[model samples]
Target: MRTAEEIRRVVRTAVEAAVWAPSVHNTQPWSFSITGDEVGIHADVDRRLQFQDPAGREMLISVGAAVFNLTLALATLGYDPLVHLLPDPDRPALLATVRLGGPVTPDEHTKMLHGQIERRRTHRGAFVDVMIPRNFADALSAEAQAEGVRLTPVRSESGKRVLAALTRAAQEVQAYDRAFSLEVLRWARPPGTTRGDGVPADAYPLRPDHTEPDFAQRDYSRDHLWGYDRLPSATRPSAPGLVAVMSTVGDTREEWLRAGEALQRVLLFASAHGVRAAFHTQALELYHLREFIRQEMLEGEYPQMIMRLGVTAEDAGTLRRPLSEVIEEDA
Candidate 1:
């Protein structure tokens, strides 16, 4: 049995790891509270994107990813994380409560995933042309299946083009909408910004680098001279890479949470193999487009995340709020 101080130390370390989980637009829209051997993950509603994520599906998914990281940290530390999702109906903000159970030795795979908690990054631009092993997608699918989610790779050329075209259409519509544009602008950090809870300028290229079929990226640099200077190699048209959609059988708060957990699992597993992901969820934010994709592509499964996975040479930067801003200790 561990002492009280030891448990507290492990809990804190787990929270530290949890904060590194990716969130939409780097909102980091989650907070934590430690009480004894349990950690409570809460959705930080104030950080939710008002226009872009009005329903809070994305917010819950973001917090869910953080929950996965938290539990993974505990597991790596030889503690079984007894996770209870949506433990209280009365408190919707409390997404999960994880109780640390008896210590056990972690398996090699668990340790490998925990090793990538901080190193995994959300790639913003195109991936290199190197071919990802066909078996890798199967591995990632298994990862998602472990969390009760499906990872469907868009294999056909026509399918990829459709998804890309929908992404472009969504990006264009959102760019023209005053409310949506402002919401994106709010999260798109300027160059040399000290703020840590938004998409930093260094995370994307100054000018958009279009992929084949032209999947549109979020206008993080919208009308401003923000973002990193791309290398000459980065300027050329790059491969679209492997496109995949994460989906759930039903679209509910619980399913959203599962999807988020699955997403982090897949991402960490890929990151361990030196692969990265770039998200293009703009189409999912819109109601009609999302429904269309569900009917046409996903076959009734609710899409939770749309991303392109491959290897990238560019080192994209990321930022996170200090623990003091997001954690509460009641130990």
Candidate 2:
């Protein structure tokens, strides 16, 4: 059995690892507090994308991904995490409370995922010539199944093109909406910013490659001043990697959280196998477009995440606020 001190140490390390989970524009919208033997996970409503996610569904999903990472880290350390989802009905902000439990040796898969937590980044550009192995997609689909979510790979060229066009339509419409544009601009930081939250200017390419089907990227860099220099040799159009829709049967806060957990699981698994993902949540965020995707593309399942997974040489750097800023340690 591990001592209390050892448990605390593990909790701290897990939280550190959990920060690396991807968030929309790297918002890092969750906070934590370690109390004796348990860590409390809460949604930082102030960090919520007010205009984009007014209902807090996406924000909670981001928090849930952090929770999943925390659990995975604990498993790697040979302890089971006893989690209570939204335990307090009145305190809607508290997403979960995970306590360190008895030691249980982690499997090879757990350790592999733990190793990938900090190394994964959200890709924002074109993919290499190679096609993703279908076997890997099967492995990823199983990972999603473990969390009550579905991962459907859009491998057909026609399916891929339709999704891309929907993404483009959603991006164009949202860009013109005053409230939505402001929400995204709020998170796009200026270059050389010391702030540890939001998507830094260094997180994407200054010149985005227009992949086939021409899926558009988020205009976080509206003025074309954000992101790093385009890869010098990546001048030609390339494949858009593997397109996928992460969905849950029902669209509830709980289901959204499950979707996020599955999202990170799929991401980490892909990372371990040399793949990175670029999110095109544009369509999912638009009601009509999302409905079209659900009825046409997903066969009526609620689409929670839309992304293209593939290989990229570019390393995108992300950031999160220090634990002290968000954690209510006194609680």
Candidate 3:
């Protein structure tokens, strides 16, 4: 049992942790509302990427990741989070509602993940010449499975090449398309910016490091000078790292949310072991390309995220909106 003020404090802490979850272009498309002991997670539709993510799949996924973080924060604070996904019929934007109940000892694993909520960053360049252990890989897959998502590591050389080629093709097309380019540029921050809601210039290298298989990265810098000064070590072409795809059985809103939860959980698990992930999601944005991946690569499973995971010496920083900008009070 807990008092009203204690519950309010816990909810506040949870929202603070929730905003740190990664979003497409750091859109942070989520808002929180506290009503006594319950917390409501809402998707901020205005912040959604209209051109790139018209279906709101990515936006919902981002909200779901926040929900996962909120749950972990509650658990770290010694409470059981009772969750209801898409709870209200009249309010479709309401993604989830969490109510903390009962005090219990925080598990070691829960604490480990909670500790990494603010530390993990999305790696953009090549990874070090090291392989993630089999045990850790297995654990990551299991963690996704627990949330009804599948994390399949693309291990074969041919598979890697196919994914890389598709990524390159998508990147080329998106770069040349004016609308796509403008949309991406909108979220890419110039260097020395004070804005805390977009992908920062420091988040990626000035020049893209061409990995062996050459999975292309998003051109956040565009044409102007807007990235970190290249380090010889950081820019050296290296292994493509462990390529993986996150998939779900269905492509519904519910499945997308679950995929996001799985992704955040897996990311936290990998970060706990000093591993980081770089996303190559442009191909997944195209309908035909995504279907090809679903049929050829994922055995007909709907692909949600395509990523490469490995260890990195470079520690990049990410940005998030403050709670004041994202949270609302109940009227």
C-alpha local distance difference test of each model: 0.91, 0.86, 0.89
lDDT of 3 by residue, 24-60 (tens): 9999999998998899999999989877899999998
- The TM-scores of all predictions, comma-separated, are 0.98, 0.96, 0.97
TM-score, cand. 2: 0.96
Best by lDDT: 1
Tens-place lDDT digits, model 2, residues 305-325? 988989887788787788777
Clashes of 1: 0
**Candidate 2 vs candidate 3: which has greater TM-score?**
3
Answer with 1 or 2, whichever has the higher lDDT: 1
- Each candidate's number of clashing pairs is 0, 0, 0
lDDT of 1 by residue, 1-331 (tens): 6899998999999999999999999999999999999999999999999989999999988998999999999999989999999999999999999999987799999999999999999888888787777799889999999999999988889999999999999999999999999998889888788997899988987777778977889888878888778667544538878899999999999999999999999999999999999999899999999999999998999999999998887778899999999999983
lDDT (Cα) of model 3 = 0.89
Task: Single out the weakest 10-residue window by summed lDDT for candidate 2.
Answer: 230-239
Question: Which parts of model 2 are misplaced by more than 4 Å?
Answer: 231-237
Instruction: Order the candidates by lDDT, highest first.
Output: 1, 3, 2
Model 1 segments more than 4 A misplaced: 233-237
Q: Between the candidate structures 1 and 3, which one is better when assessed by lDDT?
A: 1
